[model samples]
Target: MKAGLSLVACVLVAGGLGAAQDYSVVLPTVDVEGISEQDFTKGYVAPSNVEVNKNGLSIKETPQSIEAVDVQKNRNYGTNDLSSILEGNSGVDASYDTRGDGIKIRGFSVDGGDIYRDGVRDSGQIRRSTANIERVEILKGPASILYGRSQGGGVINLVSKKANFSPLYKLSARAGSWDRYGGMVDVNHVISDTFAVRLTGDYEQGKSWRDGVKYRNKMISPSFVVTNQDGTVSFEAQYTYDDAWRVPDRNPEKSVYDAMGISYNKGFAHNGDFVKDTLHFLRTELNAELVHDINLKWIAGYRKASQDFDNFFAGTYDVNTRMLTQNYAAQQTDNTTLSSTVLLNREFEGERVGHKVSFGYDYSIEKREPRLKYQRGFTASIDPFASSSSWNSARYDRVSTHNKHKAITHGVFIDDLITFDERYHLLIGGRYDWYEFKSTDINQNSRSYKDGAFSPRIGVLYDITPEHTLYASYSKSFAPYGGNGWVGVSTTTNDIQNLAKKQTNEQYEVGLKSEWANKRFMSTVAVYEIRHKNNRYNPDSNDPYLWAQRDEKSRGIELNLLGELAKGVYMRSSVGYMSAKTSGDEVYGYRNGLELENTTHWQGNVFLRYAYNDLWYLEGGVTAYSKRYHYVYNDAAKSAKGAHLPGFVRVDMSAGYKFSKHASMTLAVNNLFDKEYWRSSSRPGDRRSFMSTFVYEF
Candidate 1:
C-alpha cells in the first residue's frame, strides 16, 4: 500500500508544470468538517462540503430532503458503498438482484436508481465501489423534476474525492473474518498552481460463509485533472475496472419454496448443482466547465459504461406419479450506455435571481439471451450423487433465444431561484422529456411513442432570524417503462408493450433549519407526505410460478436531527412512519382485490460520536426496522396465515486512536448483540461481524 501511494505521488508530481501559471484550476475538493459528528469520532473526514450539485451548498440551504454521510461515519459504521451506508437511513431498503451483481433500493421493482458523481450521472448502474467515494448524499422525495427520470422516493449521490491539490499521500491495509483482506492507496500533487493529479485503487477477496455466498472482487481506478484559475475552465478524466466471482444458492429448490411458503410442483426446477458468476465492467467520463467574468457559465459532460454477466442454474423438481426429471434454466445479459449533457447558468434580477438551463440525451442498448430445457420427472440409477446429477436433463442447450433492444431519452430543463429580498427566496423548475424504445423480439407490439411532461417544483426559504430558516417545497416525478417479455407461439410479434403503467409520484414537505449557540450546534426538523400512483404489480399471483400485475400506494412521514454537543460529542438521528396498501379495486392479470405487502410502517436510526483528546475517539449507533408482512401459503392453515418478519434492531460501535497527524488505528463491530434477525422477509439474516484497520497519511 505504501509503495502504491508513493508511486502515485511520484507520477503526479512528475506531471506538474515546470513553472507556476498565473491562473489556478478547478478540481475536486473534500469538506471534512460538514460530515456528521459520529463520523468525526471515527478518524476520517470527507474534506469538502459534500453537498448536492457540487456547488458547496449547505444542507440547510438545499430545498430538498438531503443528508450526507461523511467518510468518517462510513468507517465507523462498517459501510462499503451506497447500499451499506443507506441501510442506516430511515426510508431505505436493499435487496439482491437475480444475478447477484448489485443491490436494489426501496421496494422499487428495479435494483438501482440514478447515480451521481459530483452532481452528474456518473454511472446509471447500481453496482459500484466505495473507495472513490468521499461522501454520500440522500435526497428524499420526488427528484425526477431536478434530475432526469427517477423514482418518487429519492436519489443517492456519491461525491467522488478530488485531487488533494495540497500534496498528500496515504496507504492502508486490512485482513479480517471470512478470509477477507485488501488494501487501498491515495495520493495527490499540485504540479503547479494550475495542475494536479490523483489516483486510488482496491483489491479484496473472501471465502464467504453464507450457505451459497462466497466471492472475491478486484477494482482499480486512475484519474487526471487540469484547471485554470479564475475558477473558469477545467477538465477531468477517469477510467475504472472491476471484476468479481460469486456462488449462488446451494440448497435445492423445494427448500426455498418451503421457506417462503410458495407452491411448487415437481415439474419446475430451482437448484443449481453448481453456480458461478463472472462480471466485467469498464467506465469512462469526461467533464468540463467554462465560467465567464459575467454571471454566465457553461458546464458539459459525457460518460460511457458497459458490463456483461453470465449465469447458469440447473436442477430438477418432483412432479406427479412418474418420477419426473425437470430442468429449469440459463440467462445472459450484455448492457451498454452512452450519455452527454450540457447546461448554462447565469444570474439575473441584479444578482437577486438566477437561472440555469440544461439539456441532455441518453442512449442504452441491452441484450438478453435465455434458454430453458425441461423434461418429465425421472428416477434413474445414474448416480444422483454426482456433482452433475443425472436428473439434469440439459435439453434447453439445443434451443437458443436472442433478444436485443435500445432505449433513448432526451430532456431539457430550466430552474430559477428568485429572491424577493435578502431574507426570502423562491425556486421553480420544469423539464420536458421524450422517450423511444425498440426491440428485435417485439412484433407489432414493438412501438414508439412521444410524450411531453412538465413537472414543476416550488420552494421558499424564509429567514426567520440570522440563526434560523423555514423552508417548504413540493415536487413531482414520472418514470417511463421498458419493454416486457411475452410468450409467442410460432413467430415473435411486435406487440410493443403499452405505456399503461407509467409510474407517478409527488411529495409535499416543510422543514426548519437552524444553527444555534454560536454555531456550535446545528439541527433540522422536516415533515413530508409522499405518494405514488399508476403503480404496477402482479396481484393475487400466489402460485409462485405466476406473473401478474396490480397497483399500490405508499405514503409516509419522516424526521431527522444532526449536529454537535459540548466537549466534542456529536449526534445524528432520524425516524420514519409509512403506510402502503394496494387499492381495493384494480384489475390486471389473474387475481383481484387489495391487500398489504409492499408497505413498511416504521424505520429509524441514531448515531453518536465523541472525541477524548487528539489520540482517541468513540462512536456508536443503532438502526431499527419495523415489522413487514408476506402472503403465506394455505391462508386457511392455522399456522400459515400471514408470514411476519418481526421488526429488528442492530447496533454498531467503533473506536479509533490517532498516533499522530499522519497515522491512525481503528476497530469496529457490527450486530454487536449477535441477535439473529432476517435482513429480508424471504431470507435469513447474517451473523455478527468485526473489522479493524490502520492507516498513515502524509
Candidate 2:
C-alpha cells in the first residue's frame, strides 16, 4: 500500500511539472455567451445525459425512473461511501453488514453483478472507494435487457473520472471526529492537442465510535486517452489499485438485547476481528464513428481481488440467564473477473418518423476460491456484558473446506426508439442470455448447471407539453439456478432441486417527468409494481441445507426533485412508499404475507444549499425511514415488542467559505442531533460527528 501511494505521488508531481511547462504554450481561451450560470455550478442539479441506458438518451426521455448522485457536490456534507450515497436516494435502502456494504433497491437486494464501473460489471467484494468516481447513475426496475441477469429492482453504475483535454490540478484534505482524516489528489494534464493523462489518488484512515473498530483505505487510479483532433475516434486505458483494512463490527441484536435486559450499544467483535481486502482493476475502451452515420464502441475490463475475513459473532441469548452464545469464523478468498462489451448505434430520420437503434454483445467470466475454518459449540458461551478480552479465549478449528466456483455468461441484446412527429416516442428492446455455473469441493466432488432466459422491455411516452412527459413501461429480468459471483449456488441435491426452477421477475411502471424553471429544475413521479416468481429460500431453520421456492412482490410510488429551487437556493429531495411482501405459499404457512426483511414502508430525504454570498454558503439535509424488520417472520411471539429496529430521522448540516478562486473550506456536522439507530442486521448507524475539508485548485 505504501509503495502504491508513493508511486501515485511521484507520477502526479512529474505530470504537474510537465503540464506547467506547456501550460502557456498550448492553452487557449474562447468566448462563451447565453449559457446559464447555474448549469455550470449547481451541485444538486441533474445531468441531462446518462450512460446507463447504452443508447444516448436524456434523463427526461427514458420512460423508467432513474437518478444520479453528484459525488463532487456531495463531498461538502462529508458523504463519501456508496452506502451513504444510496441511502439518501429514493426507493433505495443501504447499510453495512458482516459481509460489507449491503444495498437494496425497491425492497430487493442488489446482486454483486448488478454494480458496475463505466457500464461494465464490477464483481469485487470489497467496499468501493469514491476517490476516482465522478458520479453514480442508477436505473430503477428490471434492466436485464441491457445489463443481462440481475435483481429486478435496479442497477448502479459508477462513472469514473477520465482524462479530458482540460488542464486541472486539485488538492484536498479532510478531518473529522472519530479520528478520521484523509487526503486526495486529482491532476489532469493535456499532453498535446490529441492526448491527455489524469491521475487520482486518496488515502484515508479512521477509528470508529464502535468498540474495536478501525479502518484504513488506499486507492490510486491513473488513466490516459488518445483521440484524433476531430474526436471521431478515441482510445483510453485505466488502472486502479485499492487496499482496505478494517475491524469488523457485528453488533448484538437490538431486539434480543432488549429482551435479555442488556445494552445493545456494544458490539460482539473481539479486538482481533478484522477484514482486509485488496483489488487490482484494469480497463480499456475504444470508440469510433463508422460509415453511414453509425457509431461503434468496445469496452473490456479485468478485476482481481483478495479478501481476509476473521470475526467473532453472537448467535443467541438466554433471556433469564443473560448468557450469549459466541461463534468464531475465518476465511480467505480470491476473486477474478473478465468482461467485455461491443455495441453499435445508429439514427436516421424519415419523412414523418425518426428511428434510433442500438445493439450489443456482452461476455463475462468470474471465478472464486474460498477456504473456511470455524468453531461453534456450547463452551463458547459468555456473559452478555463481558469485556472484549473475555471473547478472545475462543478458538477456531483447522480449515474445514476448500471450494471453487465459476460462472460464465453470454448475452445479445438490441433496442430501438421510434419517434412519431415530435410528440410520441416508443422504445422496444430484448435480450437473450446463456449462463453456466460450476462448483468443485476439496473432496473431488463437482456439480454444474446451465440455464438460459430471454428478457423483453417496452415503453411509450407522450409529450403532454413541451416541459412535461407522461410515460409507461414494462420489463422483465431473470436469475439463473445458481447466483453470480461470490454468492455461489448451492450444490446440494435439495438446494439444487429447489433452485432449478426458473427464477424470474416482471415489472410494470408509469411515470411523469417534468422540467421546471426553464429546465433549471426537474421532478419525476413514478409508480411501479414488481413480481418475483420461484424465489429460493431456506425452508427449515433446523435443517439449514433444506431449500424451497416461493413468490414475492413489491409495489411502490416514488417522487424525486432536484435542481435550483429558487434564486440562490438549490435542493435535492426524494420520497418513496413501498409494500414488499411474500405473495405465495411457503413451507411455513405463517411466513406468507410477511414483509420482506431489511425493508421500510416509508423513506424520504431532503437536502438544501443556500449560497448567501459569493464567499459563504450554508447547507443542510434530513433523512428518515420508517421501522423495518430484520427477519421476514417477525411475529409477536417470535420477537419481543421492542425487538424491531425503530425508525429514526437524522439531520446533517454544512457551512462553506471560499477564500478565493483557488481555495475553499467546508465544515460539516453529520447526525446533528446525535440520533442512535440500528441500520442493518446487528449493525448500528454512526453517531454525531464533525468534519472539515480544505481544497485548493490550480
Candidate 3:
C-alpha cells in the first residue's frame, strides 16, 4: 500500500515526469490521499468497475453478474489460496486440501477444467497459488461461448501480477500451529522506458494435526512486459513443485461409525504413501489498437504437468477380528498442452444505433497419459490399534501407459453489444466448436472420436437508473462425451460406451443490481435455473453400476451485498437457497426429490474488515451451511429418509498493525471454535489454529 502511494507522490512532485524521457509518463496529480475509496477497489471496498472486456461492456452495463477482489484485500485477510479467496464472495463455497478445486458455485462444483487463469484454461491436478495472483474475477452464468467447453456454472479467473514502471520489493514470513512455516518474495524492476520485469516466489511446509499427514510447496513465476505507445506485450513463465501424504476421506457407514464411538480425525493413509505434482506454464500476449476504431489481442500459451498418486484406505472392516481391508490404487499422469486465442474488437455506428462487436477464435491441442506406468498395489493386513510395521508394500514401474490420448479443439465466436437510444443494451453471441479425441496403445492399435456442437447466449440490460440496472439472460453449454480433457477417455472402447454422444447444459437467469456511496457499495439479487446431465453411484441395481440421470436440474436464489458500510468499514457477504435434484428412475431422499448428494441447500458467509486510522486494521468472517445428504445404499428404503451430514459454522479473525511505512505484522486465528463438521461428506474440518506474519517492503 505504501509503495503505491510513494509512486503517486513522486509523480505529483515531479509534475508527471517521474522517469527517463524515453519512458516518461504524464498525469495531473492533485490529491492522491483525497481519492475516494469507492472509485476503485483495494482493501475492502469492492470495485464496481472491471478492466477485462469479455462481456463487451462496463461492469454495470453488462448483463451478467461479476465480482472481483484485489490483492491487497486478500493479503490483509491472510488468504493464501484460490479457495480461501472465494469463501465469502457472492455465496460461493470453497475448500482446498492443497490439491484440486474444492469450490462450489451456484450449486455446481468447479473442477480443474472449469477454472481459468487470465482468460485461459489453467486446469489440471496441480494446486493453484495466490503468490503471483493480482486479483480473482468470477463471471457468473454459462461461459462456454467465451471459454471453450464449460458447465453452465460460470468460471474463476486468477489474474497474475505483472511488471510495472515503478520498482518495488516485498518480503514476508509466517509461522503457525501444526508446525507450519513459510515465506514469500515479490520484486519488480524496470529495465528501460519500454521494458520491465517482475518475479515472485514462495515456499511453504506444514504438518497436519492428523497423524502422518504433511505437505510442501515451492513455486516461482517470472514475468516481463514491453510498453508501446499504441499497446503493450507481456510474457510470463511459472513453475510449481508440490508433494504430500494425503488421505482421501471416505465417510464410514453411519451405523458402523456410531458403533465404534471414535473420532473421525484419524485417517487411513500410511506414512510411506505419497502424492507428487509438478507443473510448468508459459504465456505470451499482445494487445494493440488497430486503425479505424478497431483493436486486436492475441495470446499463446503452453503447459506441461505430471502427477503421481498412491492411495490406500480402509474400505470395509470386521470389528470382531479387527481386520481392516485396505483398498489401494495408484494413478500416474503426464500432460502437455499448447493453446492460442485471437480476438478482434471494433466499434461503429449503425443506421439507428451504435455497436461494439467482438470476434474471436480459440485453438488448442493436448496430449495426456492418464496411466504413465502400471503399478502393483497390494491390500495390507493391519489393525487400527497395531503398529505401522505390519503394513504391506506397494510397487510402481516406469513403463508408459498402454493407451495415451491426444485431444484437439477449435472454436470460433462472435459477440455484439447493440445499444438503442443509449439506454437499452442487447448482447448476443454464438460459437461453433470442433473437437477430436484420439487414443494409441503400445501395440499400435488406435482409435479416434470426434464431436461438434453450437452454443449461444443472449441477454438484455435496461438502465432503470444511472446506478441501477435490470437484466435477464439465457445461455447454453456443451460437454463432449468424456469431457474436454484427454485424460477422460482411453483406447478401451467400453470405458465410455454408455455415453455415445455429447451432453448439453442450459441456464436461465434474471437479476437486479444497484450501487451507492460513490460506487463503493453494490447489491444484487439473482434467480436462476440450471439443467444438465449427471453420473452418480447407485448401489440399488443388482450389479451396482453407476446410474445416469439425463435431466438433472438445479434452481436457486442468490443475494449478495458488497463494499463499504461506513467511513472505515467494509464488508463482503452473500447467501443462497438452492435445490438440486434429479428426475429419473432412481428417486431418493426426502419429498421424493432426492436432492443431489453433497449439494449445498443453503450456504453463506460474511466477511468484514475495519480500519482504525492508518496503522491498525482488523478482519473477521463467518461461514455456515445447511444440512446436506450423505451417501446411502438405499434411498427409497422407507426407513432411511432424512439422513444428512451435520452442518457447521466456522469463524476466522485477524489483526494487523503497520509499524512503519515499510513494515507490518499480523496475527490470525482460523476455525475459531474448533468445530466438528464435514464438507461434502468428505472429512472432518481442520481444527483451530493460529498464525502470525511479519512483512517488510522496500
Candidate 4:
C-alpha cells in the first residue's frame, strides 16, 4: 500500500510540473491584530506585527525573540496539530501523548497556564485542534507584565479565524495512513452592508499504527461581525469535541530485553490496558472598538470545558519474572472561565521625541471541579511475550473524590514606546496583579489564599540602518502555587507544601534583527539566560511523589530565518542550543549541575519550498535533536547502560498541484527514510507515513 501511494504521488507531481501555469491564488482575509490581508498563497512568510504582547508592537520593535507559524500553509505539510507545528520551531520542544500536548520553551516547561486563544487564556489539559486556528504566535521569555501568573518560559497565543467582509466558501477532504480520513468546510456570507457571518467546521477520525488506537475529533465555530465608521464589533462562538481510545505502548530496555532473548518489538501491554478520553469545549467572545482615534478596545470572553479520562497503563517490569504490572487511574474535570479586558492606546507626536503609550486593565475568574479515582494493582500481571484476554477484570479500589478550586485575578499594566531622534527606541512596561485562590476538598475542608505581585519589563533598541537593529531587554514573571489545573492546594492534607511563596522567573537577553532582499526576508539572533526560583521537585528518590522547592537556570542562543530566498523560492530555518541545569545546594537525591530531564542540548529545523511554476510546488524539511535524558537524576550507576534516547534526524517532503482555479491537491510523505526513533524514553515515534488532501474553493 505504501509503495502504491508513493508511486501515485510521484505521477501526480510529474504531470503537474509539465501542465502548470501562472495561477494567482487568493485566500480569505484574516482578522487579526497587526496583520493585514495579503496573498498567502505565494510564500509562507508571516507578518511581522504581532498581538502576543498586548502592547501592539512589531517583531523588530519588541526587543524580543518571536516566531509565527502560518497554519494555512503548513496544512500541506501534514501538520494538523499544535505540537506538530511547534516541533519545527527554534528553542521549542513539543510532544503529544495521552495526557494531551506538552511543550517546553527555552528548556522550561510551558505545558499549562501559558497557552492562549485570541489573547484569552485557554485550557491546556486537552489536545488543541488547529481546525479553527489561523496562526500561532510564540513570544519568548518572561511575559508576566502583560499576562499574569504564567510560566517564565514564554507564551503561545493562537489567533482564531474570525468573520470578515469578504465572501468565501471552501470544502476539503483528507485521507492518510492507518485508515485516517476527515473533511472540513468553511463558509462566509455577507448578511448586510455592515454585517458578515462566517462558519468553519471539521471532522476527523482515524486509527493509529499502534495496536488498538483510535481517535475522533470534531469542531464547529460560527462568528459574526459588524463594521461601521466609529469602530467594529464582533462575536464568535466555538464548540469542540474529542474522543480517543488507545492502548499504551511503553518501549522496554533493549539491553535487558535482548539479554532475555525477547524480540525488540514484543508488546507487553495487555488488551485490557487502555486509555479513554473525552473532552467538550465551548467558548464565546465579544470584542468591540469604541473610538478610532485613541483605539479604545474592549474584549469579553467566556469558556466552559469538561474533560474525562479513564486509563490503565503498564508499569514496573519485573526483570526476573518478565511480568508487567498494571496501574489504573481516572479523572474527570470541568472548568469555567470569565475574562474581560479594556485597553486604550494613543500616540503623542513631537519633533525630537515621540511616544506611543498603551494601558490595559484585565480581570479573570476561573472555577474548576476535578474528581479522581485510582488503584495501584488494578489487574493481574501479564506476560511480556503472550497476549492476554483479561480486560477490566478488576475494579478500582479507591473511591472518587470531588474537589473544587477557584481563582480570581486582576491586573493593570501600562507600556510606553519612546522613539528618540527617529533612530533609537525605548520600551518600559509594568504590571501589578492581585490574585485570590480558594479550594474545597471532598471532606468540606476549605482554604483560601491571597497574593500580590509586581512584574516589570524594560528594553532599548537602536536602528543601525534601514535593515538592521540591535536590542537588549530585561524582564521578570511570577506564578502562584497551584495556579494551573495540574496542581492542587489542600488544607487538610500534608501533601501540599510551599503555600506562602510563589515561583519567580527573571531573564536577561540581547538580540539583533535584520532584514534582507529589500525587506523580503528577515533573520533574528538572540542570546538569553533565565533564572527560575521556587521550582517544585522531588527531593527524595525513594519517595518519588514528595515535592520540595528547588532552583534551575537555563542559558540558550537561537537563530531564526524566514521569507523568500529567491523568486518563487522560500525558506524557513532555525537552530538553537541550550544548557539547562539545576542550581543551589544539592538536595537529598538530586545533585547540582545535573541537566534537566527531557531537554536536549541542540536542536534545529530547516525547510525549503520551491514553486515549480505557479501551479505546482515542492517542499522538503528536516528536524533534528540531540540525545536527552529521560530521568531527572541521571546517576550512571543506577541507570541502564545506553538508556538515554539517542539523537535522531527525520526528513519530510510534500508536493502540491493546483489542478484548476478552484481545486488543488497535496501529497505529503513524513519520515521519508522510515527512521526508527523514540519520542520519549518509553515511546517509539511514528514510522514513515503518507497523507493526501484535496480542497475546492467556490
Q: Highest TM-score: give the candidate number.
A: 2
lDDT of 3: 0.65
Give the per-residue lDDT digits (tens) of candidate 4, residues 1-698: 37435534543443243224332111123435233212333336757677686776778889889988777666655556677778757788764455666678887777667878777787646566777778888999989998887768889988877777667788999999888888988887888756778888888778666655566777777777654322243444555554544554533443445555764455555444555445454555433332333444456677666666665553456778877665566677777778877666677779899988889888888887887775434555556566445433464646557889888889999999999998899999999999888888878888887889999999999999979999999999998873333434555546455634688889999999999999878999999999988776545433423556667899999999888889978888888998888776344333667677677888888989887476888889998888865553445544322356787899988888888878888898889998887666655667788889898888
Question: Which pairs clash (backbone N, Cα, C closer than 3 Å) in model 2?
Answer: none
Per-residue error (Å), model 1, residue 675:
1.2
Which tens-of-lDDT digit does each residue in 50-113 have in candidate 1?
3454322356656766666665456443446455566646566543333432332233432334
Model 4 ranges with Cα > 4 A deviation: 1-43, 229-292, 376-380, 388-393, 482-487, 492-499, 538-545, 632-642
Q: How do these models rank on lDDT, best leading?
A: 2, 4, 3, 1
Question: Which candidate number has the best lDDT?
Answer: 2
Stretches > 4 Å off in candidate 3: 1-43, 48-56, 70-81, 88-99, 230-259, 349-352, 372-378, 387-402, 441-445, 482-487, 493-498, 533-549, 585-592, 634-643
Give the per-residue lDDT of model 2 (tens digit) for 71-121.
766655566667877775778887676555677888887746688888877
Model 1, stretches more than 4 Å misplaced? 1-51, 54-58, 75-81, 96-112, 117-126, 249-329, 348-401, 442-446, 482-501, 538-550, 588-599, 632-641
| Residue 369 in candidate 1, Cα distance off native in Å | 7.9
Which pairs of residues collide in candidate 4?
none
Candidate 4: deviation at residue 330, Å?
Answer: 1.3
